[model samples]
Target: MILFPNAKINLGLDILRRRPDGYHDIETVMIPVPWCDVLEIVPAKGSETTLTVSGRRVDCPPEKNLVMKAYRALAETVELPPVDIFLRKIIPDGAGLGGGSADAAFTLRGLNELFALGLSDSRLAEIAAGLGADCPFFIYNRPMLCTGIGTEFTPAEVSLSGLTIVIVKPPTSVPTAEAYRHTTPSIPQTPIAGIISRPISEWRGRLKNDFEPSVFPAYPSVSEIKEKMEGLGAVYTSMSGSGSSVYGLFDNDILADCLTETFAGSAVFSSKL
Candidate 1:
């Protein structure tokens, strides 16, 4: 089985409070981006399990990869043979791009169908949440109004089909824990669903990412990318997730190439998923 798992950008993020469990309580609108990772799984021929990865800048030990974790999770319940899993990485790791979570979600989804596990969407979501907060998002793969550790999600109607998105990743690694340490609970709130329903033009200034303040000061380069995107006439610009990646939305492609050329140190390009 082969599947493509896409990355997501947070349109608006609000950290409501810190929870007793160590994770923060958050509310955000997550939208899918065309940027994705590919996963291929085939039945194992021998007793030993095997996994491989390929693509630009792919990092991570094969045994530690999320795909293998997902495979093992299913294997525990069913007496299955070894499986060969291959991951083609495109999204940058630790950039808040949900690369690992996406791969795990795709594995669960693909394996369920491939092995005829007969797991319902809700059941698969249960497994996904065990892996990570972002894992559940890929199970539905659509715009969502997410809250409470990103597991409690409600579907939202929003599309970026006609918009051009410029994704920029500056050279920085943001630890999720550190990002939360600097996060302030007094985050501005907005009608996220309403804002998403409106035209992209209307989203120019009304929406905001709560993580921006906490992350920008820690990583000045990330802040610079956000400012540059705004300067390029993006209708909306914000940092996704905990930190380390920023994206801008423009109405057309005229400024796309220009921005990429200017931001050479940080990888920049226009994409849609």
Candidate 2:
């Protein structure tokens, strides 16, 4: 069976408090983007699990691949037949794009369907949560208001189809742990999710991301990308998650194409979501 696991961006990420479990409590909106990774899984001959990975992020060892871990996680519950999983990765890793979490969630959903597990969406999301905090978002694959280490989800009545997004991933990588370490917990009282769901024209001063303040100063170039996108008539622009990847929203593809051409060498993607 073949399935495409899509990536997601954080609309607004706010660190609320540090929990005793070492994981910080957070309030954020996760929006699904068109950017995706292709995964193919097939029944195998042996009892042992196997995985092959390739594409934008290929440095991860096969043993460390989330698809393998996902398969094993299911194996523990059911004595599954051997499976050959191939991951054609396209999303940038560690850029706060949720590539790994999406893959794990996709595996859970796909395995349930392929093996006739007949698990409900809530059940699949439960398995996804075991894989990672962000994994549950991919189970429904929609824009959501997420909280509680990203396990909680509330659907947002938003449509970003009219806007084109310019996503740029700088060559450098920012570790999630390092990004969180640099951030101080501050809860914004603004009705974050409600504002983003409004028309794109209204997003100019309403939409906000708390991470941009601390992250931009540490990396000026990341801030510059967001600035340039807005300077080119983007209605709203913000850093997706912790750091590294920044996205700008436009009303037309003509502007999006122009921005794409300007950032040719840089890893930039133009799409509508």
Candidate 3:
């Protein structure tokens, strides 16, 4: 089976408090973008499962890849046949695009179909949650208001259908752990879901990402990209998650094209939401 796992951007992220389990409580809106990675799984010839990756180069051993981990997680519950997993990665890693999490979620869905596991979405999501906090969102795969370390989700009534979204990933990485270490979690004055309910134009002043305060100071380039995007006539712009990748939402297609050309050297993607 061939599956294309899509990427997502955080509309607004807020760290509410630190949890007892070493994870932070968060409130955020996660929205899917057209950017995607391709994955294919087919029955292997031998008893051993195998993985081959291509495109944009995954920087880890194949065994440690989330696709492999997804398979292992499922294998523990059900009998499975050997399969060859192929991944073509295009989404930038550690940019808070949820590329890896999408891959893992898609793998669980694919395996259920390929092996006839007959699992429900909730069941699959339960298993996916063990892979990553963001994994469950991809299973639902739509705009969601997320809380509780980003695992809990409710459908968000948001539609960016007429807007152009431009994403840019600078040549730097923001480790999630490091970003969290620099943060001081506190509840937001205005919750992201409430902010989103207002007109997109109003989002400029009310909607905010808590990560920007600490991350922007540490990695000025990411902040600069956000500024450049706003200067280029974006209706709204923000860092997707912790750092490194920034996105601009625009009603003007011409402006989106100009921004794409401006950041050609970096991994830039422009598409309609």
Candidate 4:
């Protein structure tokens, strides 16, 4: 079966505190976006499952690829034949866009359906949590208010229905671990959901990503992207996650095309939300 795993952007990310497990406690809103990667899985002629990727090169070895990990993770619980897995990447990684996690989550869903193994989304999301914190969000693929290192989820009422989204990923990639090391976790007085409920124009200073303070100083290009978007009259602008990818929401379509053209060499995507 074939599946297209889409990307997601963090509407607002707050690092609440450091946990006992060394993972930080976080609260964020994740909004699904249409930017996607292509994955296909089919019964294999050989005895072992395999993975091959095209388009944007994955930085890790195949054995370490999340796609293969997802297959193995599922195989551990159920009977399965070997399969040939193919992935075509369109979404850029390390953009805090949840591309890899989305791929892994979609793999589990695809496998379950392809093999006729009945599993509810809740069950799948439960399984996905073992893969990555944000992996579970893709199982439902909708607006979600996430907490607990980004694994726990509750449906979010927020919507970008009438807006246009423009995303730009600069040439560099941020190391998530490094970003965390440099960050200081603190709870916001006003919750992210509350800020989101306000007018989009009011989101400027209230809705924030805790990672931006450290990320922007280190990666000015990413910072520049946010600045440019604001200068271009974006009603709301923020770096999606830790670093390297920034998104802006606009009320009209005019600047979406212009932003795409402005950042030609980067991985730029524009779509109506």
Runs of candidate 2 with Cα error greater than 4 angstroms are: 255-257
Off by over 4 Å in 3: 255-257
CA-lDDT, candidates in order: 0.81, 0.81, 0.91, 0.91
Which 10 residues in a row give candidate 3 its minimum summed lDDT? 254-263
**TM per candidate:** 0.93, 0.93, 0.97, 0.97
**Cα error of candidate 3 at position 161, Å:** 0.8
Candidate 2 lDDT, tens digit per residue, 135-190? 88999999888989889998877777777887888877777787888778877677
Q: What is candidate 4's lDDT per residue for 117-207, written digit by digit as tens?
A: 9989998888888888889999999999999989889999998998988889998999999999999999899999999999888999999
Question: Over 4 Å off in model 4, which ranges?
Answer: 255-257
Cα-based RMSD of candidate 2: 1.7
By TM-score, the better pick of 1 and 3 is 3
Q: Report the Cα lDDT for residue 250, model 2.
A: 78
Clashing residue pairs found in predicted model 4: none
Instruction: Using TM-score as the measure, name the better of candidate 2 and candidate 4.
Output: 4
Backbone clashes in model 3: 0
